[model samples]
Target: MDKSVDLQHYYLELSPEPVRFDAVSQLTNVFFDDAKQQVFAVRSGGATGIVVKSATDGQNISFCMEDRGTIRSIKFSADNQVLAVQRNDTSVEFVPFNANNQPNVPEMLTHQGKNIIYGFVWVQERQVALISKAGVEIFQLNFEKRTLKSVKSLNITVNWFSFCPTSNFALLSSNMGTILTPVILKASTITKLPRLELGTSQGCSGRDVTLAQLYGTNAIMILRQLQNRQFEVVIYLLNGPGLAPKKSHILRLGQSGRFAMNIVDDVVVVHHQASATSMLFDIALGGAETEVGSGAVIHQPIIPAKTIKPYTLEVPSMSLDGKTINCDLYSQHWVLFQPNIVIDAKLGCLWHVLLKLNSLCALITDRFRLVEFLLQRTEGKPVLLNVLKEMMSVNYSGTMLPVIESIFNKLNCLYKSVLDNELQSQMALMALSTKSQSSKLSPVPRVIVDQSDAYTGVFSSITDTEQLGKILLLYLHSLARNGITANPELSKQIVIDLVRNKQFDTLHQLLKYSALNESKPLACFLLSLSNSDPSISQMALDMLARLNANEIILEVLLEKGQVVEALRIAKQMPGADSLPARKYLEAAYKTKDPLVFHSVYNFFQAKNVRLRGSPDFLKHEQCTEYVQYYQTLISTQCL
Candidate 1:
């Protein structure tokens, strides 16, 4: 069943409909605010009007703007109360709106110094950051006064700046996009992070440097086009205490062309313009080790390049004349944004690429890597659980053994990690009264599939109980191999199946290695099976002996007419004097064996001499009745 890929490998697809706008006008400018997920279109330099559309809300808000002199940079403040429009090299005009959202008289604010403004971003609801050639300046917007107040400023030569709203950090690149500094602008504060220096032969352009959070790590990704026209994305991690950016991974993109990146569910999706396909890469998957001395592991795409599933644009636009149209994806005017947004400015269409998670299962050939990759995904557990069911439904084969082993091991490792984290958390809580003593608060990609989940989802659903039990043995073995304990119920089920199949050797090993849990009920159940298999019963008895269950042991022995063994066990046990000595004699008398009767009487007589200073049954001993019964039995034997 492994490597059963879909015919088209349709792992990714476009949304059913592309977001439509007035794209017919080539004179209009389209800009996307990564912070708010809003797309803005200013027609003929805002002479027609400004149209703002939110991808999430699907609502459009349009406001008229008087002719602005060649608007260079424009965006709404975080609260949409003020419209920030940059027209010149160093000044931005802030226009506040009234209760009716009509633009008021604009207030102009220039840069801190003469440095030309490269870009600007809305850092907060009322704060905006201006990135310039020399540094960044953060300003607080005073919507009531229709003015701007300078809050914080930093001076460092910068070539470009990239911000990731998810991580709330911005990257500043200088020295031709090689030396990068990171900053966190949030809650009206600017906090500087460590600076990283890239030693690539040639620095990347501003459009090539991207900042994003991949699977809980703040990552700086640089897309470099090789001499052969091939491209690779170098990832540097901005985690760990006071540590410099570490080049931990490099995605080996074999194809060459214009490339754009989108991190979907921690999986990096690289879209190639020329091929019109996206290749998936997961950092969690193992790949070739080390390309540069930096020791960055080189990774290949998770699957082959597959085109986005075709989509039909349903929105009727002025250009389309009220008709549904099939649009060209990956078009010449298509602009890719961080995370997963894609837009074609000329068409005035926007779409968020979606991953077909179930389709991914079929595309991946290696089961181990599939599990490894899926285990880290946010919605992977359910998919993985389904995969197990599929595997179960398939016919067993020798080739499937290793595949099952790999999956089981991966699941166990993930479970182990979860258990370890929980234990550490508990210990940390113990060290403090109200707070944990731990400091690392980073995200780790893990699938939380435990043995019980697998059993319930896959194993127990099997109608063939016999085969299910066999598979359960293999499953339990895997857990045991990983130093994990199984539920007692699961242990009992497997043992029942083994016994029913008469697999004594394997059953013995299960008992020997202590894979099965020991309990009085299990021991009694095993003892019941003595008639069928004496060895299994002995195994049960041994287990009980190990558990020191003297009462059950004595009961079993007396019931079997092993009066000597039962009495001996009772005598060796603590509080033997309190044990009913007369009971053993009575049980031996019921046996009607002369020798057994003699031995039972002698066993009690020895106890009486040791405790009462004479070898005679005392009145309170309560064995005189059994002694008389034994004499009568001996007399009958003589007759």
Candidate 2:
């Protein structure tokens, strides 16, 4: 059963371009430019054919160059018009390309360095950076002037570095990758953030540190060996300026030999070469040991560590056409880039890692945590709805009730947060548009699971009204805590169920506290339940009373033969004399109680006198018929 769940939950899908290898140079000539999502094959320093291809967009750009010793780092401008090549320690060579593959005059751009240039990357269309033992230097290339101008440079001793193109962010490591400095590299500006010093317990190696965006925040995921000698991926989120970057998570890869990582759908997927399997962790899980200031450490994988989904690669075959063959799931030569890009230069293939959320539904036994994790995904709502619907479809036995309750709590918690934030944002925007003293801008809000979404999608189809009533009440009680309006149809069902179970006091308190959605139709529904328990009618009457819906209140009172109560309410209205109290008198007449009939008559008679100074009915007044009935009742009683 576990294997069945693992079969489809996570895997790697092939990107468009899998075969970008040069048969002549094989794996030896190729290098990946992650910033452009392109792979380049430099044949003999480009004296032979040079080729560039992208797995992302099927982009291919090729040019030739006279042998420039060994190309260390290479990248092309955004427009593919200028190529920056690093062949030596002192400087980077910028060669402009005109039209298709023709070279212009090459320009040498050197950086201020006590040390040589280690590697470089193109920050923007014409901006590039050179990192060395000394520091990082960002420079701009002016094609028109044929010059390389210095932009901004940071002076700090660096051992190695990693870059995330998504935010134009970089992490420079020194003191053996334990001391880290974060900086934002823009086309014209470099915002260097505060330096972070890793604790001594964590390893001091520089090779294992990688920078990437996880959950939309630029963070460093370092594969470190702890003091206990166990390997863990220690992640530190680099927050905005003035806020110190903090260590947020620790993903334990027990007995790790060599592990690589990728962030997919905000989940951290760690691939271990020795085990030939991958383990996934969602920090949102808030692991058992989420101790404050110690960073949350996830002791176990979400699902047992499993190999990547099986895939077939196409290669030349003995048949007339190429045939697909099973590819190794976790190859030693496989290279992983941030946010789900994987490449195996030796196999001449690139496969993108993906998480199949639909299959994940089964492996996540803790339903509440499943929902909380899904709430953060881009394509999660429909999946969440489907999962919730399945949970609702179960027989709703007592054992599963706690699990369902937990799921509801998670959904409502997220819903209330999203709703409150959106309302605040809207209010702020309105204030800003008018330029009022209250002008303020709220943080943008994100969508999440809400109450109505659950009802309409999951609970509405419930056939067992009894079970549904209990479940609905549970969900509604959770929603009530969040201050969200409960669904009326659901409220009606709950009231009926409560009445059936003889939970009148609970029902009364819920109505009195306004826990259920209050509406005239709901009040009437409660009136129907009065046959089971008379107090239920009073519940309905009280609900109407709170609304000041005197008309409906009078109908309910008279219908129940509570003539005196009905008359009292009619008298309390603003236009008490104009109130039509004839129904109250008629109801009293029907009761055959002469005293009740006579009291009702006197009240109307007094009202008539106050309105027109006549005890008898006026031409416009409609009380003559009631008066006759009252007199008949009195005579009948005397006889």
* Model 1 worst lDDT run, 10 consecutive residues: 1-10
After TM-score superposition, the amount by which residue 287's alpha carbon in candidate 2 deviates from its true location, in angstroms, is: 2.8
Please tell me which predicted candidate would have the highest TM-score against the true structure.
1
Number of the top lDDT candidate: 1
Evaluated at residue 512, the lDDT of candidate 2 is 70
User: How many residue pairs clash per model?
Assistant: 0, 1
Candidate 1 per-residue lDDT, tens place, 459-544, comes to 65653433443455567777877778777776666567567767677678778866676788888888877776779878988899
lDDT (10s digit) by residue, model 2, range 493-539 = 66765776676766776777687899999998888878998788888
TM-score, per-candidate, Cα-based? 0.82, 0.80
